[model samples]
Target: MIHFPEIQSEIQFLTKINEVELHILREDQIYPSISGNKFRKLKYNLEEFSKGNYDAILTFGGAYSNHISATAAAGKEFNTPTIGIIRGEELSEKIAENPTLSFAQKAGMKLKFISREQYRNKSNPEFLEKLKSEFGNIYILPEGGTNELAIKGCEEILNENTREFNYIACAVGTAGTISGIVKSSENQQIILGFPALKDSGFLSDEINRFTNRSNFKLIKDYHFGGYAKVNNELLEFINDFKRQFGVTLDAVYTGKMMFGIFQLIQNGFFPKGTKILAVHTGGIQGNEGMNRKLKHANKTTII
Candidate 1:
């Protein structure tokens, strides 16, 4: 049996902003490697794998994908074989220089790199059939690990301790985490999602597909550039935030969300006396790889 650690993420109070009680749901503390929403998203999937007759677990991700890192760690801990279908073919030869890919490879995840065009066809029937042929009896987890089971696992993120909050904020990637948050949220609470990608308006449709609720809103201005893209301001905010709160926010997700949350608060987005809970959906593992890129470009790195 695959035993999951009990869901006991601490709700930490950050500070008061315009009379809004700003707090953070520290999902990042759930584990050392497979922390935050990654743990929630992968829980049931791994459990199903443990129960089933599968030869290996396969998933897709970019070079610095948190899903890839978390899935690799989980596969290692659970003693299951894993295969990572990486998006960039060029990265195959550069794995030694990439921390995320190197960690996944060290965790026994077979790495398969594909061109961007081929990766775009990942959900295509023919592409899936070819993958099945290449890796027999493999259980495939979608890119970002967002599926029905993942949504179900994410529903557990909110519980009695979080019921009193007036707003819940989380970083939106594939929309699975917020969908589960929207599902389990009280009717009076508003769920806010900060997308890390530009032109991410379609995420509303994605979230609606999982749940029929309408209490959530997407804050679209904080993406900076796009997925995995960060600016010096963001990097500085991340470093300053860590200095102030002692909480490290990953650049890809939580950092952007927290930055947006602070900006919204300054703009008086929330009513005075409202309670806001921001979910720290961890992606800190990607920092080392990101810093490597930044250092290569002679740019600022996350501390």
Candidate 2:
């Protein structure tokens, strides 16, 4: 596993109204090669595989998945062959042309794709058996890199963060990062999730894939539009946040939570003078994907 240097800071936002405290937990500080939530989630998947004496690592992701990128980096760092099972049939026709797929291949990893329906059964035993038949003995990790062992490693992130926080918030795509923080922290802290997508009742199912119970709520309205989708408000907030705090907020994940936090504060959801800790789950590399999805958001205005 690639170990990143510790990065924790008390950031003061120079807002037009007043300063907001965004306790930045720099997962990026971990390592540029394998940083962010992807690293946290995959760390223990690797651990589990090693403990089991597995030959290689096999996992899932999309075109611009941080999980895939980090898995490639980690597998390479650990001297393990990695296989990426991507989504969609477009991969079959022109597999190498896809930038992410290409990068996965170039990184000494193999990239393969299946039908959308097949992708649904990725967690099923039969599909896993099929994978084993083809690749020989290998380790299995779920998509979004969410697994029980992964969440266990994620807990360490919060333990190492030296900040006294009243509320801890994070952008939840798979709920692993949020769950890790909630299950690891003291009872005095409350965890909140800002989903980056729409219609996320299925997120509960994903949570069940990890632990039985957790202290967290998914604030669904902040999605702006949906996963990878963004609006003018989100973009404006991104611009303003960068201008104000000298920190970059990507539209896919952190941008959604940052804007949602502001709106929540305005709506009297997060009261003033409360210490709020925001986990910057780094998917900043996916900002290019965000640019594409923003075009479909329908309400266009200057960011």
Q: Which candidate ranks first by lDDT, i.e. highest?
A: 1
Which residue ranges in model 2 land beyond 4 Å of their true spot? 1-20, 92-97, 160-163, 205-214, 292-303
Question: How do all models score by TM-score?
Answer: 0.98, 0.86
RMSD of each: 0.9, 3.3
- Alpha-carbon local distance difference test for all models: 0.93, 0.74
Could you tell me the lDDT of residue 249 within candidate 1?
93
Question: In candidate 1, what are the lDDT values of residues 48-97, reduced to their tens digit?
Answer: 88888889999999989999999999989988899999999999899999
> Tens-digit lDDT track for model 2 on 1-303?
334344443343334223345466666546667767877787767767777767778998888888887888887777878998988878767645455566667787887888889999988999999999999888888888887888887786686443477778889988888778777776777788898879788886776666666667788888877877766767888988777777777787888887888777667775556777777777776665555445556543223
- Candidate 2 lDDT score relative to the true structure: 0.74
Q: Which ten residues in a row have the lowest lDDT in candidate 1?
A: 1-10
Prediction-by-prediction clash tally: 0, 1
TM-score between candidate 2 and the true structure: 0.86
